[model samples]
Every structure is written in C-alpha cells, then in structure tokens.
Target: MSWQQTTLGEIADIVSGSTPKSSVPRYWDGAVAWATPTDLSRLDGKHLYKTDRTITEAGLNECSARLLPPGSVLFSSRAPIGLVAINTTPMATNQGFKSFVPRPELNADYLYWWLRANRRQLEDLGNGATFKEVSKAIVSRVKFPLPPLTEQRRIAAILDKADAILRKREQALTLADDFLRSVFLEMFGDPGENPMNWDREPLSLQAEVKIGFPFKSAEYVEEGIRLCRGANTMPDRLEWSDTRYWPVSDAARFAEYALVSGDIILALDRPWISSGLKVAEVVQADLPALLVQRVARIRSSVPAEKPFVFQCLRHPSFWSYCNPTETTIPHISPVELKNYPMIKPPRELVAAFGMIAAKQSVLRQKVEQDAKDARQLFQSLSQRAFAGDL
Candidate 1:
C-alpha cells in the first residue's frame, strides 16, 4: 500500500462553528438544524441526522454558523473534545466544534474513521485556560496519512462491519439486563402495585441500611485500606479503577464502615444514570475496604432473603417511588430508601428464586464475555486500518 504524508489542511477545509444569539426570539427554533457537543456525545452510530435544537434561516445569516452539507465530518473541539460524527443532512453546530469538509478526492467516511482512531491524540492537543480546547489552526496543521481513494473506502467498509459486530455484542448485554428484569417480574409481579399482596414492609425491617462515613481527604494515604466511594458503584457491579487509599492503622478506627461480601452499596447522590441505578453488590474481591461518604450499604438480616431484597431495590417500581426528578440533582435519601415498599414473600419461595437467578447468571456470563471480545476485536482492527495494514 502506498501512502502520502500530508497535513489536515492539504486535504480538507477546516470549519469552525458558532452559536446563534440566545436572547433573540427570532433566532431560535426554525428550519436549520443546530447541534452541540452534547448532541454528538449522545450518538451510538457514526452518523448524525437530528439535533435537540434548531435555528431559523435569519439566525443562520446573522451568526457565523454555516450550513455544512451532507457528508461533512464533524468533530467537537471544546467542553470535552474528540466526539466525532458524520452528518447525513445539512446541519450547523455551536462553537464547541471544529468540523471538516474533505476535498472531493477524499472520502468523508474514511475521515470519520480516522477521527475516531485519533480521538486520544486530539484530546491531548487541546489547550485552554478555562477548559482544554483545540483551535482551528491546531487541527489543520496536524499530520494525516493519506491513502488511495479506493483503499480509503475499503478500509471504511471493514471498520463499519467490525463496528456492527461490536454494536450487536452491546445489544446482547442490554438484552441480558432485560431478561433479568423480566425474571424479577415473573417471580414477584409488579412491585409497585404489589399485585401479589403478600404484605408490605419497609426495607429497613428486611435489611440493614448503613450510610458511609465522611472520611477526611487529608488522612488519605498512598496505599493500604481502599476507600470505596459512591463513584465506585455501577449498575450490578463495582469499578475500583480510580481509588483512594488510607494507612493500615486507619482501618482500626473505621471498623464499622468496613465493607464485606454480599453487601449492596448504593450512591446517595445522583444515584441513577442512563444505564440504571448506581448500585452494586460487594463481592469477596471488594472486601476489607472502608466505605466513603455519599454511599449506603444494605445487608439482609436473613441471608436467604438477600437476593429478593436486592432485586426489590433495583426494581423499576422502586426507582419510580424514589422519583429523583423532584430535586435539581437526582438523589435517594437514606430514609426514603429504607421506607421503600417491599413485598413479603415466603422464605422458601425467596430461596427458590435465588437458585433460579444464580442459574440464569451463568448464561449472562457468556454474553458479557462475547461483548468484551467484540470490543477488543474492534480496537485491534481500528489500529490496523489506520496503520495501513487493513
């Protein structure tokens, strides 16, 4: 394969975006589609066709915003740079973008993939006082490895197929989540309506809800006892990649806050995300860790009832009962979570359901593995494609 060394400026016209005046009533919500970095970040696919806001023709003329024709490769430059997408329709963006219009000799889809492959490099290039930003001059002057037009299209095609497989694997994981929720509904019925009417009890009576202590940052050490924070909690699992630690001597003073296996931890602040609640089950690997503030731990009095109680807190009904929308920052109060209505099922029934759930998890493990493999495969191909080995 032959390649040519060229700057982004030699093969593409760099375009900077601008926002319409917000105060002008006539400048808002019209025929022109207007987008921002937030809009690009929300996309699951490479192409963008819609935006949350629009602007009038008069607004477009009044502002620096220019209509980008279909096939333009858009890249966000500020307020978290490196979100890339290809436009399928005419669109304009806010100042948060430094987009590209490739020369006729260049394939737009190829450019989009290049942007995806170099996101980290672009992020590193961003420089600003308030928040990092990549100026138009910086982007235009960046090095670009150019291949033949035929080869560019072929490379894009291969990546598109790999991306499709990666997306399907993601869908499988999502389906696994749905399958678990369905099983919950089948065994217990609608938790909100308590259709079974077995009896209602506050969560506090069924389990112990312990709030995490406010460990002072000044006392933090380089290693030893790990501090489990609200940020560590994820849906159904815990992520300890970014962790803080305390000295071994510090553990003796915070014995009560020490975490153990089977304890369910929930975030007290912004407890829910697009994926679901910020709750996780503590496994043996997470033990010997001390809890941090803005987190709560729940443990059942009867070990047999553990699975049932965990399901109840994660149920859609319980989420609705919390109604996090009432406040500016969505949250769940300890009192509110403890008082969440739970159905009283027989101990034998709960135990039987737990057995079934454990069996189902075996199948979910396969789906999770497949998803991980798909991610690795895509990453490898992306590296090869841009390196001219595809």
Candidate 2:
C-alpha cells in the first residue's frame, strides 16, 4: 500500500540558507545560533541542541539565513550531502542546507527519518563539478509518500525507539574502546611520561611502514579486490561500506601492498580528525585488500609488538605530536611516523597485553556485529515504514 504522493515543497516551507561575511568580527559569536553542514554532521541523534558557530542578529539580517523554529528538519545539501537533523532550538544555517519547516500535518521526526532513508536518492540529485550540491529547487521538487498526520507521528515514534537501540549499541562499543585504552595505560604508562622506565626506540626498529600506491580513479572497477584507502580507516576499525575496488586480474602486480592480519594502517592525509588518529589494525576479515595512496601500512618486525605499536598510534598524544595546528595541511609524514619514539615495554608485559588485546578483539567484534545488525534493522524499518508496510 502507498500513501499520498507529494513533493516536499507542498507540505513544507522550503528555506534557503546563507553565510554572513566572515571577515567581519562583529558578525560572529553572537546570540543567534548559526549552523553549517559540520554542525549537523557532528550530531549523534536527530535533534540538534546547539551549533558550533553563532551569528549576531545584525549579522543574520545581513545574510539570507533566517532563524528557523524548533522542529525544523535540516538537510545538508553539499560538502558531502544527506546529513539530516531536527533542531531543538531556533537555528540559522549556511548555504549548505536546504531546510524544511514542516506544515501542521507533517511530523518533523518523520521527515528526518525519511530523508535519512532516502539519502542515496537525494545524493544522486546533487550536481556540480568541484563538489556536488543539491539546490533548493531540487530538494523542494523531490517527491515522497505522505501518510496521514497520525501515521507520520506513529512511524516517527517507532523509528525513534529503534534508533535508541542503535545508540545504546554504539555506546557499548565506545565503552569497549575506552576499556582498551585504559588497559593500555595500566599496562604501560603514558608514552609521554614513560613512568615505567621502558626503553624507548624509534618506530622504524619495531615496524616497517610502507606508503601505498597512487591508484588512479579512472582504473577503478565495480567489483574485484578492494582498495584499502584512508577513507576505509578509523581508530581500530575499518569501514568497508563505501569501498573502492581494483581489478582482480591486476592484483598480483601489487602483491607487496597486500594487507594481512596484524598490519596497522594509517591515513597520512589529514590524519588527525575529531575522532582521533585515522589508524586501524587489519584483521583476518580485512584480508584480500590492496593498499591505495596516502595510506601507510605498518607491519611489526616482532609479531608480539603489533598490539603495543597499534596502541601507541591510537593514543591521543600521538596526534598531539603531529601539531596539526602549526601545519598548512593536517598530515602525518612518512618520516615523522618512522621516527616516532616508541616506548618498548618488556617482552613479558607485551605478551600479556597482547593476550588481553586478542580476547578484547573477539568481544569487540561481537559488539560491532551487534551494532551493524542494529543499524541494518533501523534501515529496514525506515524502508518498510516509508513503503507503507509498517
């Protein structure tokens, strides 16, 4: 069964956003809540409580951005699109958003989930050479199935509960991550302090760091051996959802760059993100993948050192050493990584930590699988809800 077909503009007030002149000092840090795509991207849930940047009332008046009322659905239109959030407070956004103020019959949460569910469709509507952006006209013209007002609220409530489950699972994974970091600290004091008098050595002695090949985008294939690039790497995790592929026939040419379990991969380009260092250790599941440019693969000289080497890189202090603020581009160089001072714990202690790490890895894998399942469940719910099968 299908609900009434309707365009977004028919049921919502389409609002275009703009930025105030950044050069003016008086325009920033004011009472008005100014938002950008980054603000929406930073949020963990549907409701955005605050913004990273704010504008003065005078500044808001000087630009096209208007303060949207609470419950307005914000959809990021560019700089990587399809970020959706509902504002809990009045917010004004920059041009990257084509936000929607719902009519009395349209539920805000419903719109939020609908946009999220149909992200790929929305992304396909984007157009631009340098970067893709979905224009106000494009977003407003997009059609969706509109259920009755009561049905919308009910659907939103159900999705809300489902999303809460996903969040809880995510929280559990985070706690596991924290536990590993704490374990590292307990076994070996902070490398910055080196309180245990562990003999320090340059990372090159314990690990071989090799940068990746500059794989041309034109040669990318639909399916074959996967290319492991910076985008696939996160702290202690490799996300293969948006993976790129290389031709399997040519895989033998890059045999040296093939990833094996226990290898640590690091992103050399803008390596320091808000989420800590872009580093991950390859597991058995990540095998049969070849390396791509701007990503470094570190293999342990002594297999027992693998766990410690990875923890050293995952540490927050490792990023501090990068001093990203001083550099024009936030990057970690091959030389810097090779020369990184590593605190070498005693072999006995390293073996103990390795044992603990392996056990934790198994537990973390199960939790991660649960998290993946929860996300898929939410996606399925959204699809059925929108398809009127709920």
Candidate 3:
C-alpha cells in the first residue's frame, strides 16, 4: 500500500476549545453538549453522544466554542493526553482539546485511530510549568500516514469490527457481574434496607483491616518480591500493569503488608472515579506481592465465610459511603472502613450465595480471557494498518 505523508492541518481544520464562565448560571444546564477530557475517559463506545455538562446558546456565543459536526474527531490535549473519540452529535469542548474537523479526503474514524497510534509523539510535543499540554499549533503540525480515502475507510471498518468484538466480550463480563449482584439480593436482601432482618455488625468485628508498609524508594529492587500499588487494585480484580518490586531481604520487615489468598484490598486514596470504585481480591496467583501504602488489606477474622463478607463490602451503598464526593481526593480511612456497618445473614445462606458466586467466577474468567484476546488482536491490526502492512 502506498501512503502519502501529510500534516494534519492540510487535511483538517484544527480548532482549539474553550470554557464559558462557570459563575454564570445561564451558561450551563442547557441543551448543547459540552465535553471535557473526563467524558472521553468514560466513553463506552466509538461515538461520544453525550457529556457530563451542557451549555446554552448564549454561553456558546460568548465563548470561543464552535459547534462541531457529527464527524469531528475530538482529541484531549492535556491532563494525560491522547483520549480520542468522534462526536456523533454536534458538540463543544473545553480547552483541554485540539479537535479536528475532517475535510473531503480525510475520514474521521481514520483520524481518530491515527491520533491514538501517534499519541506518544503528541505527548513529546507537550510543554508546561504546571501541567503539560500540547497546544493547537503542535497538534496542527502532527504528520500522519494518509492512505487513499477508500483504503482509509476500509481499515477503519476493520478496526471498528475488532473493537466491537471487545465491547461485546466486556458486556458479557458485565452481565456476569450483574448476575452475582442479583444472587446477592435474592439471598441476603438489600444490605441497606435489611428487609430480611439479618443481624448487623461492624466490619471490623468480622475482619481485620490492615494497612500496607511505607517502603522507601531505595528499597525497590529489579525482580524480587512483587510490590502491589494502588494502581494494581481494579474493581473485582488485580491488575499487574505498573507493578513494582521490593528486595526479598526487606520482605520480613514488611511482612504485615504481605497479601494472602482471599484477602480483599481497597485503595485508600483517589479510590473513586467516573467508572467505579477501586477494590480487588488477592488470589493465590497474586501472592509473593507485598502491599504498598495507600492500600488497605482486609481479612476475615474467622477462618470460614470470607466470601459472604466480601459480597457485603462489594455492595453499592458501601462504595457510596467510601466515596462521597469531596473537594480533595475521595478517601476512606482505615477506621472508617473498619467501622462500616454490614448486614450479616445466616452462615448456611451465606454459603449458598458463595456456591453460586464460585460458579459465576469461573464463567467470568472465561469471558475476560476472550476479551483480552480480542484486545490483543485489535492492537495487532492497528499496528499493521499504520505500518502499511494491512
């Protein structure tokens, strides 16, 4: 495949976004879709149809915001850059973006993929004293591999199909998660309502909330004991990306933070985002990893019935208590977590729910594996398409 190398400015109009005065009441809560980087981060599909905020006609007229058409490609330029999405409806964004209005020759979806492929280059262009940002000038100067219109559309369609497969697999996993919640509701009733008249107990009565060790920077080693940071704690699973290690010699000193099988870990700081809470379970495979500070490890005081309490902690109301919106980072102290109220059902009933959860866990693992494979294939296709191998 022959590709033409051209700057983004030549094929598309680069527009810098702006914000309206927040103090003005009429400026917001209106019909126009006003977007930010957060909206792109929370996107679940290819096209961004809505946003967290909206602006009125007066606000749009007063600000530098332009009404972007359906095919305009939005690129976040700051606050960890390179979240790319296309607008399905006309929308406007804050100054965090440097969006592109495609011309006759360029396809919006193709440009979205190009921005993602070259995100590192865009980050390299960022400059700032406070937080780094790539200016509109820098964005306009980005050169991309321009394939023929027909070829561009073809590649975009293929990548779209691959992305859809990943989405469907993810949806299956979500449904499996929902099924567990349904089972919980059926067996125990709502933890908040306590309609079943189950006995109430402080979480600390059933489990011990242990904090991680404050390991020094010098204590880090190449490949010794795995160090689990806050980033490793995902919702319902442990994510290994950005994992660190500590020397085995220091393991004894931090032995209290050593994670065991069936231990539940919760992120103590910045735990809440637009997506969900940050909590995970330490499986047998995740052992030999020392828990780092800002992560709290919870273990049942009793030997049996741990899964029963795990589901209680996973309750929506529990996360709400842990993640009440605040001006600073949303956090739940060890004391607050330990003292959390829980509705405990009978042991036999708890065991029954655990049995069903165990079966669902097996199904979830299979779906997750499929999703991972689909993502890997999508990435491979993206690399090949950009490298002119597709």
Candidate 4:
C-alpha cells in the first residue's frame, strides 16, 4: 500500500454557511438540522444524527447557509477552530462553520478522524490574536496522509466499534450514578421533607464547613498544586479536565482549607443547574489542595460517617434544599447552607448508605477504566489504518 499527503482542497470542496434573518418566522424554525460548535462537543460518533436547532428550507434560500449532504464534514472556523463532525442528515450550519463535501475517492469517516487527530494543527492555522479562526483558504490547504478508500472504511468500522463500546460503558456509569442517587433518597426523605419523627440537626453540628482561599488568575501556573474550581465539582464526582493548578507558593494561604482525603466540596451559586454542587473525595495523594473561591468544603466531623454524608449530598433531595428561588442564577448562601438540616437516621441506616455508596464508587471507577481502555484501542486502530498497517 502506498500513502500520499495532499491538501484538503485536492479532495474536497470547502463551502461556507450563513444564517437567515431572525425576524422571519418561517425561516426561524424548520426541519433542517442547524449545527453549532457546542453541539459538536456532544456528538457520540463520526456523524451527527441530530442538532439542537433546526432551520426551514426558506431559511436556506434566504441565507448563505447551504444544505450539506449526509456525508459532508463540518468544521468550526471561528472563535476556536478544528472541531469536526460528519453530517448524517441534511443540515445547515451558522457562519462559525465551514463544510467540506468530499470527492468520491475520499471516505468521509476517514476525513473526520484525520481532522480530529490533527486538531492542534488547525488551531495553529488560526490567524487572529484575540479570537482564533481558520480561513477557508487555510482549511482547504491542510494536508494529511490518505490511504485507499477500501482501507478507510475498514479502519473507520474498527474505530466505530471501539467507540460504541466506550459509549455503552459511559451510559452504564450514568445509570449507576442515578441508582446511587435513588438509594440516598430512599434512606433519607427529600431535603424539603420535615420528618417530624426524626431528629433534625444543623450541618455545622455534623461537619466542619470552611470556604476555600481566594485565588487570583495570576497565581495559576501550568502545574503545581491541584486546584478545584467551580467547573471541577459535579453532582457525584469531579471532572478531571476541569481541574486547574496553582503555584506552590500560594498553597500556604489555603493550607487550612485544603481538601482532606474524604472532604466534600459544594458550589454555592444558584438555579442549581449552573451551581457545581458535588461530592468529590480527594483520592490523589497530592490532591490535598485548596478549593478555589466560591466553593465550600465540607468535612465530616466523624471520620466513619464521611462516606455516608457524601452520598446524602448527591441526592436530588439535597439539591432541592440548596436550589434558590425563582432567580436567574440559583444559589444558596453560606449562612443558608450552615442552617440546612439533615434528618438523623439510626447509625445502622447511615452505615448501610455508606456501604452502598462505596460499592457504587467501585463500579464508577471500573466503568471509567473500561472507557479509557476502549479509547486507547480506537486510537491504536486509527493510527494503524492511516498508516496502511490495518
């Protein structure tokens, strides 16, 4: 097998898109899928099956937005470029995207994967200092190693299968998280439920609550102390990609508020959706770092009951208590949080909840590991395929 490097323009026709007038009702909402960069992030496969917004045929004619065919590749061109997804349906995109309709000799899937693997190169092509964008000419001139069409399909199928397995594992993780939440609710009534039969206690009585240090942007360095931001904290776990770092010199100021091995961090902002209230146990040896400002750290006063409280914090009932009233940003203040009450159950019941949480944590870890392995396998196959070694 022989491989050749050629510019995208040699094999595909690059087309730009436009949006229709907002005032025209007919063009505002129609059946054609309309895609944006945000939608690209949620895509599960090489081809996007649906989009958040749909445009009308009238809109297509009214604006420069063209109706791209099923196999055309879509790439973001503005703000940040290089994110790519294939269209599985006839769709139109905003000016932020540039569509590529491949020639018959090229495989759409192969092109999509190639673009993803070389995303950094595309980002480098961005010319603006403030907002990076890939010009149509620059995008068309980008080159890559291309194999025969037959090989491309085979390689794509292998990667697709691996990716499918990873997606299934991810779905399983979501279900497990839901089940854990259900268990927490069953053991303890909803946060709003005032169980007259059970003893009520302030959160301060059961745990030590402390706010994190105020970290200025200048204090952030490439790698030093692990820092937890609002984005890092989620409902049940911390998002690794959301983790940031701070210079070690700033660590002393946050030493008292540093997360212990079992402490839980909660975001205090409101409309619960945007708030990053979540329970993240400090598992990493070096992660005993401070939580950024706007986050509250909760550590169980009783060491044996830490996991139990962590589970309770993840319950939907708990979120109900913290969720703010009809406001644009849903949030609960530190004062409100300190006074929030928990229904005191028997010691055995608390232990049972802890056991369930521990089991769920194991399952979550396994699921994440499986997903990581699947991704590695897919990447290996992709590399071989592009190299004509498949």
Off by over 4 Å in 3: 23-31, 249-253, 301-304, 323-330
Model 3 agreement with the true structure over 233-295: per-residue lDDT tens digits: 888888887778998876897778888888898888888755567888788778889988889
RMSD of 2: 2.6
Better of 2 and 4 by lDDT: 2
What are the lDDT figures for the candidates, one per model? 0.87, 0.89, 0.86, 0.77
Rank the candidate models, highest lDDT first: 2, 1, 3, 4
lDDT of 2 by residue, 1-390 (tens): 758999999999989889999999899999999889888878888889999889999899999889999999998999979999999999899998999999997999899889999999999999999999999888889997899999999999999999999999999999998898899999899987889998988888888989999989999999999999888998777889999999999999999999999999998887866777888989888878999988999999767668888898888778777554456777778888888888987888988888888899889989989998999999899889998999
By TM-score, the better pick of 2 and 4 is 2
| Candidate 1 local distance difference test against the native | 0.87
Higher-scoring candidate on lDDT, 1 or 4:
1
TM-score of candidate 4 relative to the true fold: 0.82
**Predictions: Cα RMSD each:** 3.2, 2.6, 2.5, 3.8
Error of 3 at 146 (Å): 0.7
lDDT of 1 by residue, 37-139 (tens): 9888899999999999999998999999889998999999998889999999999999999999999878998899898989899999999899999999999
Assess candidate 3 and give its TM-score to the true structure: 0.91
Worst 10 residues of 1 by lDDT: 356-365
Ranking by TM-score: 3, 2, 1, 4
Off by over 4 Å in 1: 128-130, 213-226, 246-262, 283-289, 301-304, 323-331
Consecutive 10-residue window with the lowest summed lDDT within model 4: 270-279
